[model samples]
Target: MATKFKPFDVVIARYLLKPNEVFHLSKPLMYGAKINTGFGSINHDDIIGKPLRSIVFGDKDKKHKYIVTRARLPEYVINVKREAQPIYPVDASLIVQAADINVSYPTLKSVDDTEIYKEIDIFRRRGYKLAKNKRNDIKNDSSSINKKEEIIQEKLLILHGPINSYNGKTITRCSTPPLQFLECGTGHGSLTLQICKSIHASNCYFDGINDLSRGSIIHSLDRNLKHMKIGISTVSGFQKGIYLDDVEFHYEPIGPSNWVNSDIANYYRQLCDTTEFLQGCFLDMPSPEHEFTELSKYLTVDGFIIVFTPSISQIWDCYTFVKDNDLKLTLVSTFELLTGGNGGMREWDVRRVMIRNSEMVGKVVKPRIGVRIVGGGFIGIFRKIP
Candidate 1:
């Protein structure tokens, strides 16, 4: 006999008051498995046949109720246990947008393009006529239709969490073109997951190769084995429903000076010689300044480098290093909080710098301030100049 599936057979129970405590279970609720809210125990049977969005009260406490609903990624992210501070959703959204982690839809080549010609012929056969007022209405509606089309053309896949931190922002900005990305300090792997998501969303896969040697890959290096394990677990949890196989974790510590000695470094060198170049890198160590020279060797001309530091003094050190090296300081931005509480104020200082590319003279774009203020951090962006 085949099993029959019914609506509301399985449901995710969300505490109406707490919003954080959520439980997922199948229908024909197991009698022994009951979720305990602070107020009381919620029996699985109470929710098994209830429709999604229905409110069910706790068995012991009538005052306590749970908002039955399906589990979502953002909710899961918030409720998931984390060892390190994860990047907030607002910051992640900004990072994705600023870094242009978007896929562009293909465009028709010419008026004679097959799809275009077919559409035109259909319109001609319809012989549709519009009254003067109706034509004006259609003209107004065209703008809205175009807007809808634009929205469809650009799809934003965003996951909310505290995964992307200040360092994450720098990594996202530098890792444009989704080439080779190196993260010196993995922390809790919050940023690692974000990087993996970006690489996957950008569709930066190694063509004809499934190994780490091809396409865009992230080398996450950390010294502490425990932290590395935690980071890996965190990333694995994030990748549960999503596909992000380009990220590799390493336990060895990487400094700008000795990175070449590492096995991954040799792999990257081979990749550089054959197919692609190191496009971007992020350094978040105690002394990121020391690794600049070593990073330069691996980075391609016109590549991006970003360094994160909490101290304003470190920013000065990085600025001086960029000036002395064969790189151009493009932007120096610091995130700050303007408001507090649930919906808080967040802002960042954006500094524009100029660097010569090809025969074109260097030009600095005007700096602007970010409107939202979630939290504060500092980032320095540099471009590798040949």
Candidate 2:
């Protein structure tokens, strides 16, 4: 039997408009009654059970063919809708490596198996098919009324979870992150997804998010209500919520106003939870300096915080804030990213502050390069020192 496209999988459609022009559009494969691609329209009935990477829809004449294929992470990230300016895929990729996040699988034991089965049962009751598994061989019996596929479906009666390419159609990585990470500014939640993908291995297929002390995760925070909601919705919609549980969204900033009065923080404090604290932090907001002090408190020793500033001057402000506040943090690496050109990133020289014995003990400055060339941003990597 040919593999099929599920209602919620993000997919890509490509065709040649002219001999030299290739056009591509990426969208979630909803059980959409009909999808208008401008090039043409593909009916839901025609596409649901067709083989992938095949021309399932389009102007099928010799002159034009619309090819449908699965969208890769980078492709999906760039092409997906934006709630705010996205952290370009180029930058997001590097941030993962720099963070050295742990996404190891089978890290946590199953919390509850039967409780999960109920949700699966509910998912099946709604009448959605789980993509057939070769091993388990999930069968459909309309008249005989056989066992139902046990995953979630959207309100529209569309299978909105994952299309089980992995053996078990019933698996969901509902565990919290095995390691804690903070994305200070959840702009469009793009980088949050990148980090989750990096550490997803630390999780296994189970259903439901656990309020565990330590699990693999990236906690994304944004103040913009619309952007925050969109970020969560966009991520949850991907591949049917694969990384959705891996990320937890927050409206609280780490600063005094939010965390100081936050019941969430009080809960962590009541438990005396230092071991489950942040392993890494990424800042992609204006005035990231405001976050450093509070972030320092929960950041485990030797944990790293990476800040993204559009200008070198803001980096200086971060440096000044750290030094003046006597925060036990060090500026470890400075990178200048080329934004509009090739998404290139290069190490830039920092002219000040090598802290030793909690003192600014060094001064080295080189002439600025390309004074007028606006790169994507400057990134400062800081480490929490004992």
Candidate 3:
């Protein structure tokens, strides 16, 4: 909806190759602010205020022109330099959809700490769904408890609340409710970026919260610092960081059984005790079950546990581990993405294609380990077993 490209905006330039067809240029319209988009070498100065998707000539001869525009969420993920494999737009979409995510437009007036979280004799209370129309809901929200959220006992550490800093680290943040989701992997940030797009409209309406709030407060963790650094920027660089404020990237090895006892979780618990719960928990890291017992402890009664695995055995390992440990969760669904990584093309066949190795031969009865859970792997969805 923006009319012109703003400063520091990462723009996408798509050139028409033939009738009714266009393809993006290899070089992005950023960095030193100069990029040659096949038409002509574009200058940082010439693009500062240009209208998006409009024809811009590469030369004064006006021979090569491109329809320049802002990069959409999907385009940015594919084109960005990745340190690790991305979740692919296909897998990311399935994760978001299966989680039943709902977002509201963020309001400009920040939440007044006095007005929202006055009771820290206590922890933060969860927010309720008031109305879709954010423009009017915040103003007349005083008389509505009919739809108030059931305050659960699970607690979340408020990253913004007044508390002793984490080992003396600064806690410069705005007060808000406990975040809704947690992800253990921050590989290439492809899925993280996609999640940002979904929750963009409904967070950070309050003043001084995340100065760049876009309706999300995701805690994305990766043990690899290189991957974490890329994720932080890959997501922050989009749209001049329109969704940058939504995610909090942390570098931590989050998959041990003792993970709940880690310094980070302990530090959080010391500040705000057990009233915050994550609505959704995602695992894309190696051996997610190692963190399953500890992380799933923070889920609201029926919060979800979603895992993306290249091997079906991973999910099986997760399910058995949770059950064996009695982790209060139940498998809700399991799906195979036929063309999951081959872009977003979904194939539902009559005879129907199946996982790569659906069976084992000669009485060995092994699942042919590493066969993509049947040609496309699997997504395991679970719900907190109340």
Candidate 4:
């Protein structure tokens, strides 16, 4: 299989996950996607030695530090002694998912009982046909990701509490690949904090902004992530949380419904002040459609934006607003990463439709949630189109 598949090759398949498969691992299922794992690198050591979650997401301590406290050495050994500090222990759970391979009756028996094994084996061969037949039925299911945008609209029907409160999503951002971005929307701050740790682990820097600074979402997030150290190559949990290199939130009032204040001078000013190229803005300013136009002005052509809203209609409305304003626009991508009920189902729609999608003076890319943040949002990649 190693020789057949080769290294650096790309393969795709829908892998079914068993809970025990990821036991003692980080995540239960590792999607054999672009970044999760490499090609031709699958082996027992690669596969079975460590749990999938740990391999994919966990961190290891490798550096050696020294404490040079000058003291008397043994008789003539040396006046000054050199001692190396022991490596600190690091532990984390990781998840892995296998892909693109045939399974037989024997392989199925390894994980499940006789009755269950039989069902999966039947699906293995003829399941694709069954899926196609029931595609509509599968789609109509509330949890299905295949449903049309109307599902995003439908989730908004039961909005309650603070509009920006936890919508049951976890939003985290990472600069690296694979789980580089995730947005669970379960409203767990730890998910984002953990991802931030992972990004830092990759030796990358992070900065962020939130419109609702005092909101519980932020309060929980701040308390949880406050311990991370913000500068240079330092790692801190709550004990070592990074004081994000650049983070700020300001007031930008938006009228009811959709309206765009194209001349958003103040907003532009804040944008210019940031040193970090990547930033996340979770502001609920009205007319994001128009604000995007104004916001586009400041982006470095390749810069991207992540807008969270419960209204898919509003996102569509943005398309029309950009057109009417004579600002050339196109939607690069749009998809719902998660849905929730507290503050309504939060929808993340990314549009790369820029000053002109094709020939970019600068372009935008919609972000996919990398990890969950406190306020039911995800972090994604966006570049300043240059």
lDDT of 1 at 238: 49
lDDT for residue 93 in candidate 1, whole number 0-100: 36
TM-score of each: 0.57, 0.72, 0.68, 0.27
Error of 2 at 379 (Å): 0.8
Best by TM-score: 2
What digit string (tens of lDDT, one per residue) describes model 2 on residues 8-80? Answer: 6666666644312444544556565655665577665565666787775464453456677777777777777
**TM-score: the better of candidates 2 and 4:** 2
Off by over 4 Å in 2: 1-3, 17-27, 60-63, 106-177, 205-209, 253-257, 268-272, 353-375
Question: Ten residues in a row with the worst lDDT in model 4?
Answer: 91-100
Q: List per-prediction Cα lDDT, in the order shown.
A: 0.48, 0.62, 0.58, 0.26
Candidate 3 residue spans exceeding 4 A from truth: 18-32, 37-40, 59-61, 105-176, 208-216, 254-260, 266-276, 340-376
Minimum summed lDDT over a 10-residue window in model 1 is located at 121-130
For model 4, give the RMSD to the true fold.
25.4
Model 1: per-residue Cα lDDT at residue 181: 73
Instruction: Name the regions of candidate 1 deviating beyond 4 angstroms.
Output: 1-13, 17-36, 41-63, 68-78, 92-178, 202-209, 212-215, 239-243, 254-257, 272-276, 325-374
For residues 225-305, could you state the per-residue lDDT of candidate 3 as single tens digits?
677667866876777667765665555543423434544343333233463346677888777777767666767778887
Clashing residue pairs in all predictions, respectively, total 12, 17, 16, 61
Go through the candidates in order and give the C-alpha RMSD of each one to the true structure. Answer: 18.7, 11.5, 12.3, 25.4
- For candidate 1, the lDDT comes to 0.48
